[model samples]
Target chain A: MQDIYEDILRLAAGKIRQRIRAGDYASHTAGLGKGKLQANIAVMPERYALDFMRFCQRNPKPCPLVGVSDSGNPNMFTLGQDVDIRTDVPSYFLYEHGTFSREIHDITTLWQSDFVAFALGCSFTFEHALMRAGFSLWHIENDKTVPMFRSNIETVAAGPFSGPMVVSMRAINKSRIQEVIAISRKFPLAHGAPVHWGDPSEIGIKNIDTPDWGDASPVTDDQVPVFWACGVTPQVAIEQARLPICITHKPGYMLITDVDDDAEIPVIAHSNS
Target chain B: MQDIYEDILRLAAGKIRQRIRAGDYASHTAGLGKGKLQANIAVMPERYALDFMRFCQRNPKPCPLVGVSDSGNPNMFTLGQDVDIRTDVPSYFLYEHGTFSREIHDITTLWQSDFVAFALGCSFTFEHALMRAGFSLWHIENDKTVPMFRSNIETVAAGPFSGPMVVSMRAINKSRIQEVIAISRKFPLAHGAPVHWGDPSEIGIKNIDTPDWGDASPVTDDQVPVFWACGVTPQVAIEQARLPICITHKPGYMLITDVDDDAEIPVIAHSNS
Candidate 1:
């Protein structure tokens, strides 16, 4: 078989949408597209559009927005030319009255005329940058989800969307802290920089053995549990709002976007490039 | 006359609320409480709270938030021992339908059950810091409001609150840009750090002489027109929302809180203290 990333990249977004639409691919999308950008998707009613947009606005550390769609449009033209939200992600969680009802591969059957789709910046993009800068990602190496925890930090509230912030924890050797900070600061949209570093108790994380989401990793005496605002925060807020209907990408089955990783990096452009 | 600041601080938050409740003081409160933390105020309807909060979040460089209230509460106890939204500000602007209508000293008569008050970090706090750091402020020396302009930089929008960012312009000698940045960053809540320094047109001010708000200052040949996100952006957003009744501190008049200025400086606290 061809390299998974190359095969995935060659596959048109529409084909990916079709596979997801067909309920054939339900696995998380880690290391699938190599350099391609994957996004966290939030689908909500138009009535919640502004407030939800604000929630992402105030909570950019976790919800750096990549693109916002016009009302009821399934096509996220900005993210990809032929992107259709209803059939994009491999799996999605449907929330009704704030309770998880079931999982589905496609939302085409549930599409609403007043729905708005928001594609948020994800930490996965910066993980590549960190790797390029020589920082090892244990989660990718182990094929496990990044450990995430609910922090004591309160998100600036938006209407119907208020909850504790969710942050992803990474164990980094004490010596590499400055390098990680320097490398991550360059990608502000990808949860920008770590929100909290060192003693987990300081940010309200009680146990390292368990996490709010994803698999937990152990921290050695010389390692610090560095935490960055996670993109999953909006999903938690959506659950709390208890809106009539809400949909979000399944944990790691993100919406692959055409927005190039280099384009999103914040450094000044070189003239020759 | 006795120092106005001493009188204001001597009045407990409850007594000040009583005076504001009685409509006794109807003037700007700048320089009225030398050691206390004063904040720019914005009160909006519950429906617009989330987007407005996001606006502050997205544009923290210009709109550092100090305190946010629960829906329907005029009491900003988090800010002080007994701060009351209905009466503390020396002056308030009442906007209906997103247009300025009238200025008043208190909102006791127009208080709504769903109103939420946000106390923003103000420039005055950082201005005090800048002065202490040995930098000169032209507006303070000449007794005029800081020059403000509507920048071409569009604020990261959340919901119904989307518009150009407004910036307060200050002239600093070329040698002092780094010093200003170091000093100003200590008050992130008070519009920490300059957004742009050097060229006025770079951020999209066409004619630097004519400002969108406040008076203009002459930039000497060696001085740069440094810009910081202004608190006025929220005022502009509230006007844009056009809610039936929105209130904010009248330009220059602020709400004095029991917060000690020395206590709130962003410096890491000394272990012994």
Candidate 2:
């Protein structure tokens, strides 16, 4: 049964990639690529690569770097054998001088010799872990995007990269908060544990209903709003930096990788050797 | 008696700072300013501040940044109201193009308008915590420096900064390992928890008895050699980066701060507001 499940996952990923490559699927990837690691993609010129890498390093919770492609390389060999950055994602957003330029299906025409692509870990992996642990996520069940807010937290500044941390919220029962923390803490790549819980006002969120991004889910009286560092944080930083040109995956349209969702994403500290 | 203890701490820090400022005390800071936080200081030109900040952010376990001074500011008001980066530390080491230049008592004359000072958390705070928790550290008991080695562990590289992680070792009884972890994990600024334990060979330490830096501590049959991320890791990276001029506190001559030794060093993730 396990072998059959693995086969099904491979076929799903392959078929999804094909559809995305052929410009047939161009939408958010929230529920697709189940049991696989999905990544938020950021593409920029080689000149900003070093600083951007530093930015991601300093802000690992929001921008957990999964794989970084070498200059001009669209193939993320580390992420997968045949992963192509330009077309594997369902949608892409282009930003010029920190301003939104346009949304496109593919960036093959814009790919440059000096371009570098960064694949950051998304919250989907931990969300899967939470589900496996018998915790229900309202956003997924209700078919709504996870609500994200710009928090008052300031990220450690890197060169031309500094902004308020963005967080995604999920309403979890107060009793199961400890269980959620224990499960999510294991996936450091997926933003680790909740950064804030209980009080939205503490993190500068004035209204829980009105999210800066994504649709809000109902927060019951028994539930406390739990927040995790959002992958959109790097996007906020990039916009604040106002680089000449930057590209990112459109919201929810992530690049699904060959990595298993349950695989332990190695923390940076232990990988020094 | 409690008020008197606090008074003594204030007097002790002031006297030590005065002696160091006047060049009366020019040596390692070990065993000095007990119960107060001591910081490892790094000073560099503002040009490299952003990159260096990113480097510290990326490799946080090794370079747990406690405080960062504004550009051209020698006064680290965040660490201490009267803290002056130029002369408060007992001794200073100057490096040029990654080469050691000279050990000096003061850097007032060499201070540049573009210079930014960064104060990193040191292991001393955790060591004190360990000792208070009734764990006997062999190096401290024997009045020897803590054993530090270059590990196979690679720090997340940022800009021109990248090197093998340096770790400080303490021999702790196998039975007390959990207690040590619980105590040390509380001090994130002080390189929290052991990165590796038991086998030195696992982290590529060729000779446990001969550390790359500091004196070797004896590992008894019942005790395991527990390693924690060392502040020296940043010095190694700075050497590799080969910046024009980088300044750091001399070994053991840390800058004692006003922060309480046992106070919680807040994690960056929850501090958005």
Candidate 3:
């Protein structure tokens, strides 16, 4: 019998995932799937799924859930009918009880009946929107990875998950700050508006140049360092959780989804009867 | 050690729950706890929780999550530091295998080790916003309940939950409909914007006078029937799922929460480290 993911993935996102799955296009996905949603992937056991789900719900900016695969199911039906969580991302990071273990391109060898896959919104969507509006990203222009930092902002914790939020830093010209805020705020699912913009010290970032992850994009005198919640924030919480085992996408290699970035995703209802 | 649901509830929401907790307030929560958030409650076993949570996530317009009680433990710490899910709401309807088994004011005796409680956003927040803005709601002025109906629109399914959307209707003057929409959009947690307005038939409502639930509020010549997704939509899906047991707040009985109607509600992130 034909599976649900048969036809839809042949386009942009599907083609990208196919390459990643075949180990052909194994680089970062920034600017890959134009106008399509890219997501940060997290896979874990069912027991921790609910708490993690709660954590995501509570911390939506950093963890806007695009789709959650059913326990034991590899197909991310809603995300892309043809996508499989196990092989779609370019690479995966295995975390064993909060400690980094190894990286692999495919989890087909480790698929488990109890695994639940979480696809979280990535800033690439809003970044695309920013560039479209004439805001040139420094890192994108320099061909450097976006700089990320650990902030003092404490996220509301759920069971086994609690920690300071990690944020992605970008230098926006001071005069266009409001316009950037307005543009980014439109995609709440894509980490939304910047959590901290002017002072890194306010969010407890002692040094602006030394990012905990990715390449540092220096803030010039003409610009202020704007920070948006990063997808890596969940990894911090997931680390604190120290689950027996957890899987996440390596920093820039996200799961490209067929879903549109600006679609008015239909919310649903129940009959009073 | 004192529990989390402490001094905070001494305010309006806290006091109201105290009444409902003591069986002092068993009536509908409408017009109560002004400026505070109210939620619809759903309780089921852990085995069914992930799917149910997905159902709510998929059908967010009718099921904007307010708080989800940790599995087994009854404290809805997020909703109220001190609220007990088993006894806080004024009344609950116990559904056994999709059948309305009975009504009860407390579920303490039936609480199980695997029970998970769900608190969903209610339209009252938007209604309160509408009322505060000086736009008189037909039902509020007449002291009638907001009318609800089963629409032909089907909800996106998750696991075992699937069904048509149910919506609550209000008569908005043609001139004020736009204003009402703008006001409600600000409260995304409270069902956000209206799904439909003007002609009821567009959404598959065959009759203008008869509603599936609540009191009928007529739309006059200058008014249009504005329909917002109703909280009852989950119950419709829950009914179809037919789990061994399920519990929900009776139509009008809701969980009054301490959260402000309009707040930034910070979203979260993780550290790459």
Candidate 4:
């Protein structure tokens, strides 16, 4: 059963990678590549790579690093054998001195010898875990991006990288919050458990209906707003850092890696049994 | 009941701080300030602060940073309001270019304007939790330092900071492994969960009775060796970095903070309840 599941995931990843490499599927990869781990890509010059890596380390909940490529290396060997950082993602956003410059399908021409690539765990992994556990995400069902907000929580700063933590909100049924947390906590790479639940104001979300990014999902009276550290957090910090040049996966468009969503957490050996 | 418990903890902290500040007690702080979180102290010049901070961020299991002080600041407000980094720790180990110079009771005179202090969550917190959960530790019972070894696991390297991960070993009864993991996972700041178990050879341990640091305890046939990310990891990295000057709390002489070992894990609000 597990092998069959993995075979299907490999097939999905192969098809998606081919489409992304051919510049065919350039839209958000929200529901694509089922059961495969999707990553948020950040590429920067080697000079800033160390600081950025530190930034990801300092703010892990917001930027859980899954894999890092050597400086000037486009291959993320740990993430996948054939994973190429330059053209694996569906779309890329270019930043100049932290300012949004333009979007592109490939960075083969723009790739530099000093460039370093980082693959950070995205919320999509945990969202898949939550869905598999039988909890429904309203945003996915409604065909909208998960609502994200700039929370008052401050990320631990590293070098020029520092900013408020950004969080993605989901309206979960009150009864299933524990199950949602249990399943999501297993995937620490994907933001882990929700940072804040119940009252959004506790984490500095002034208005739940109006989010700073993504489509806002309305919360029913039977549900509470639960927030997880968002991958957009690193992007916000990158903009604040204002590096000479930065390349990131455009919002919603992510790098689908060969890692299984369920593989991050290792099985504990049952000594008692 | 809760208020009374906190009051007792505050009182314990005050007494420990007074003794540590007055130079009346200058030794390992183990078994002192019960229920209060103890931290491994790392102090270095501001020039190397960013990289060190990143180092802690990248290698969290070995270096879980709980609080960081501004450069040249002696006060760690986040760790404790009255906590003075210079005098709070029982003993300080001065390192010059990665070489241990000597141990001192206070670093007040050596303190510089470029100095920065970092408080890393120590294993004492989780050990206390485990003890409270009815688990017995062989090292604690025998009044010896926990056995620590250099592992094959290489920590994610940052600028001037990189080394093999060091881990502490504890033998646990076969029946208590799950309970031990469950309790430790709640304290992510204190190395979280075991990195490996069963065989020492799996993580590069050549001899079970010999350790790179600390006293080794034999694992009985009924017990399995459980390894956790050790605080010594950063110390090894610092030695490798060879900064001009670095100050750290001597082994077992930790900085006891006002934060509760159990307080870091916030209780998730059960909406159903």
TM-score of each: 0.71, 0.73, 0.86, 0.80
Model 2 C-alpha lDDT per residue in residues A39-69, reported as the tens digit of each score: 9999999778766765675566898877776
Candidate number achieving the greatest TM-score relative to the actual structure: 3
Docking class of 2: incorrect
Interface RMSD for each predicted structure: 9.6, 6.7, 5.6, 9.8
Model 1, A122-198: lDDT tens digits are 88888999888877778888878889999988776767898888999989889999889767765656877788899
Encode model 2's per-residue lDDT on B1-273: one tens digit a residue: 444334434457767787779876676676667777899999998778766765675566788777776668787665665788999998899999999999998999999998988889899888888887888888888878888999998887666889999999999899988889878876767887778898999999988999988897889899999999999999999999999999999988899887677643322322211
What is candidate 4's lDDT per residue for B1-273, written digit by digit as tens?
A: 444334434458767787779976676667678777888989999778766765665566898877677667687765665778889888999999999999999999999998888888889989988988888999999989899999998886766888899999999999889988888887777989888888999989999899999998989999999999999999999999999999999989899877777652311121010
The interface root mean square deviation of candidate 4 comes to: 9.8
Of models 1 and 4, which has the larger TM-score? 4
Query: Highest DockQ: which candidate?
Result: 3
The candidate, 3 or 4, that scores higher on DockQ is 3
lDDT measured at residue B166 in model 4 versus the true structure, 0 to 100: 98
Clashing pairs in 4: none
What is the alpha-carbon lDDT for the whole of candidate 3?
A: 0.82
Residue A240 displacement in candidate 1 (angstroms): 5.0
- In Å, residue A181's CA in model 2 sits off its true spot by 5.7
Q: What is the TM-score of chain B alone in each candidate?
A: 0.89, 0.92, 0.91, 0.92
DockQ of 3: 0.25
Candidate 1, B1-273: lDDT as tens digits: 245445755665445656665676556666656766778888888777756765665566667666666667777755665667787787888888888889877688799888878888788888998898888899999988888999988766656776778999999999989999878866656877788888788999998888888988888999988999888887777777677878888888887776666543211111000
Residue B104's lDDT in candidate 3: 98
TM-score of 3: 0.86
lDDT of every model, 2 decimals: 0.76, 0.81, 0.82, 0.80
Sort all candidates by TM-score, best to worst: 3, 4, 2, 1
Worst 10 residues of 3 chain B by lDDT: B264-273
DockQ ranking, high to low: 3, 4, 2, 1
Off by over 4 Å in 2: A1-41, A45-90, A104-121, A125-129, A150-165, A177-207, A255-273, B1-39, B45-90, B113-121, B125-129, B151-164, B175-195, B199-207, B255-273
